[model samples]
Target: MKPRFPIPLLVPLLLSVALAADDDFSFDFITHGPMLGEVTDSTVKVWARSQRPGEYAVRYGTDPASLDQVSAPLKTTIEHDNTGWVTLTGLKPETTYHYQVYHDTLPTGPAGGFRTLPNAEEHREPEHNPRGLFNFSFQFGSCANQNPNHGIGPSLPTHATMRRTLPGKALFSIMNGDFIYEEHRTLPVTNWLSQVGLTPGESPEIVKLAPSVVGLWENYKTYLSRGVNLAAWQRNMPTVFTFDDHELVNDIRGAGTTGFRERRAVFRDIGIRAWEDYAGWACPRATSQGIHFGTAKLEEGSDILTDKDADFSKIDLAQAANLHVHWGTDSAGVDDIRLDAESPANPNAGVYDVLEVLDAHRLRVTPAAVADSTGSYSIGRRSHGKFTVSNCDFFLLDCKTHRQMHDPKEPGKKGLTLLGDRQKAWLLEEMEKSGADFFFVVSSVNFMIPHNGAGGHEFAEGKDEAWTSMLDERERLIDAFDALRKPVFILTADLHNSFAIKITDRVWEFASGPLNSVNHVPKNDEGDRPATGLFRSGPRTCDIRWSSYILPDLERLQRLYPYYCVAQINNVFNMPKELGGTRWVAYPNPQVIFQYFDGRTGAFQYAEAIGTERKP
Candidate 1:
């Protein structure tokens, strides 16, 4: 039996590479590695970060033995938090090549390799191609909590094992979101603060240290940098990213509690930046090349990406510093200018210009309207390009940023939406055009069950909390999707448990992982999904006590609800399967495994997967 390697998360100082880390800090592939971006036969983009400000570049070629070739140096500045991406151009089509990160023209890190995607015009005829059959499978799962959750017991071994050895093979993977848990606005949202090493006061040191309005981003930046799970995966398999609630401060809706849009604005900007800073380069099609990051168009009201819009050339440091709450004001000062401006009389529409002001410090904010003011756009400083795997193509959607809700009391309100106008249109447009053998839609939220809280039968999780909450919008998308009638598989993360829903033979949704958090139980069987962890089985409901650290999913449930049998994985990990070349996550044998569903319905056309598509 091989050992299951659980990645130890980083310390506070490490740029919380996961929310659990900071963004865009690839320095000569120091912490992570040649995370891939767009790929064509002749060109590809690679994203990496400098732990500190410095010069960076990549040396690549078709030959692993001789990678004497090098690209121009990408200088990372402290202003961009030392994150730099490099695009490698001039290469033959459909080829495998090696690359290494270099500092000052000296070898700085391990050499990584990638194969250029097949040309679009080239058909996958075995006679014409050496790459036989051209069949490839990518792995995906979510909800890996790096910080140990003391629920049921000190995090389940099943979840932890999955986190360390997900996809097991070196195939490409997508971390659909909730890669880390920020399930609370402040620290100590759960009772396991001491256990997780998080210090908690009304405002912890982290809280005290973050910028006033957008403090959460800084908080996540610290924690995400520490995520060893994501870092490890990125080092090897090219993992794509998107966000769910935990990436922010848990279920952060478009509307805030104080009736001010500032919370929404601040959280929105923070989430986007956090994604850009840490997860930006996961997909290059959206991040590295475009001036406009998201699917939403400027005319149809898409949210603007700050790094895309932030023009420091127009402002000075003094102004930049003043825009930040922590840098500009006292602890008890005004953190938000939106609340004051949005009032009928104040109508501070452009008084402070949050978008322009936030740009000063490299922070970003989009106006509720006016996403485009400066006419032309530029794709500056891209390292990689669109995310690609050989013979397979996928489109990742950012789910969380543009959710506008309706009054829950009135479910049928006409304009109630989950995916905003621009993004929804883009998804439909892409689906109609793509010709890949398989079509995959990725998100972080679970679209399987109704918007339930604590695993109960509550169909609505507040006003548009989960996708099901928005009645009209989800239905419309479902109708359009059903019409497409292709083999559309949705891969996603977000829930603690594992699930699947077959909307149609054309559409199959598979959800795997809580990774490092509380392994989920059959929904509605347990009392409630706890704030931090899950509840134990019946008779021992709501137990947050830690018995043993190593928990196999089978032992805890007695009867396997999803039946992730032990035959595939024993107590030890990394073992090879009897199938000679393949490996198993649990179950053994070729018996097609189809367990009974928990009878949940209407999750994205009776399938599963909540969603978020983070920028590359």
Candidate 2:
């Protein structure tokens, strides 16, 4: 072959072989640092995935060279169809520990490193600061689409700089939904290929882009490929994740029989599956065959006041539904099913069913059912225990599942879609049983207020009635949690901008926007409101005091975009015995810069914290 091979062919062949070999022996590592959650002290979790599966090992120590000191090794198994993950335990709270990972079989692969969180117990007191006062810092933002044109890929330089400057600063990061924009395009082939980047005639990985099922798998693979660096970071750190619209399909509901719903379910299933494959721990254990939905106790009944106290009963059903019917439309006085009042008699009483039906008719329902159906829903569905890493107890609500399709002209017909009897009871139970300091609730959309800015109305046009219904639920939750006097924080993302608001009873709403996205910022300067401190530029930190209230001005910055925010509750150890509490300080202003290609000449524009002026 050496004597007879053509020079051009031989040269190309050699290069191909070299590239393949390099890929085979290479391992990319990402890190997410230690994170603390409700009822739980400080703990760190990390993630990583290999191009090829083999025995993998993670090692750690306080010193880079002495990883042998506290290093623990974990052997990962391929679950949920090839996603890889590892969770470390029994470490000191709040104390930082350096760590690294290596392949047992391949000595030539890359070795990665990261640091763990401080022991929480050691720093229980606000002034019990570390010898030098290590700033507790981390950044979070959502709405990152996989599209290179609008995602983190284009802003690589800014993020890289931030990472370099804040080495070991962030304990963890949360990918609060919309991680991938797979459904924007219409063509299944094109959408699937866009995710992982392979043509139809290419390898099996490429061919696996058809049928919603295969498309999901391909989408996951594609997401991992594009987020190689992110994966590397996650591998070294611990990450908490939740999904948004784009993760499955945009603005999807579960009520209808439309292709969107079916595909959405597939998207959700596969999306979660992909998450498990390439990221951190996802509940609802994965089986060799496929993934399963986790369960929660759901009840059905009337009398909102007594529902929580009602005895439990089980009814077999698929997902969360409305508890009652408040209104119905009559096409000819036949008790139009669409406008029926919220009732336990209806089979589709849960929120999920209502949403499904609404999507089917392109209309919303109102006066939704309220019932108790805990045993029915909990059967087989996945559960995230009582708490998540952010130190808050969470209730993942299926809010829009039950709603009436309002008359396009009668916006007044829309009324509150309260939590059905079952979910309400369950929520109250969780709140009463919660031993954590904070209550964190997750809804797919905003629950408190509506967007009053320009273009905001368009975003919420047909959804106003639904929002009104939500107001009651929001108030109810607040009142319940407020009565407990426990500090609660709401974490939600959907809006493409990062914002925070203080609710009554010391409750705070922290809303993060889509990462790497450019939605129309409400033309109104409402975001500039003085009380709203937007972190535009520079590093900022917040310190929690013992009074159960966050002290303002730890690090204040003005308008900034393309950034992440972290809310930390500190000073519990110094809490006074009478008030029974700790305080939080919103601190350290940090700004993020974004770069995008100008349509005119394909030049990149640099956008950063332009000023300290607050949004009105």
State the C-alpha lDDT per candidate. 0.44, 0.40
Off by over 4 Å in 2: 1-43, 69-81, 105-114, 120-138, 146-153, 156-158, 161-170, 183-211, 220-224, 227-229, 255-267, 279-425, 442-444, 451-469, 523-560, 572-616
Per-candidate total of colliding backbone pairs? 56, 123
TM-score against truth, every candidate: 0.57, 0.56
Candidate 2's displacement at residue 575, Å, is 14
| Residue-level lDDT tens digits of model 1 in 390-432 | 4234667666545554465655457765565655776788777
The lowest-lDDT stretch of 10 consecutive residues in candidate 2 is 326-335
TM-score of model 2 (CA atoms): 0.56
450, model 2: CA deviation in Å? Answer: 3.1
Q: What is the lDDT of residue 268 in candidate 2?
A: 36
Q: Across residues 121-161, which tens digit of lDDT does each residue of candidate 2 receive? A: 44334443322212243444566554554444533332343
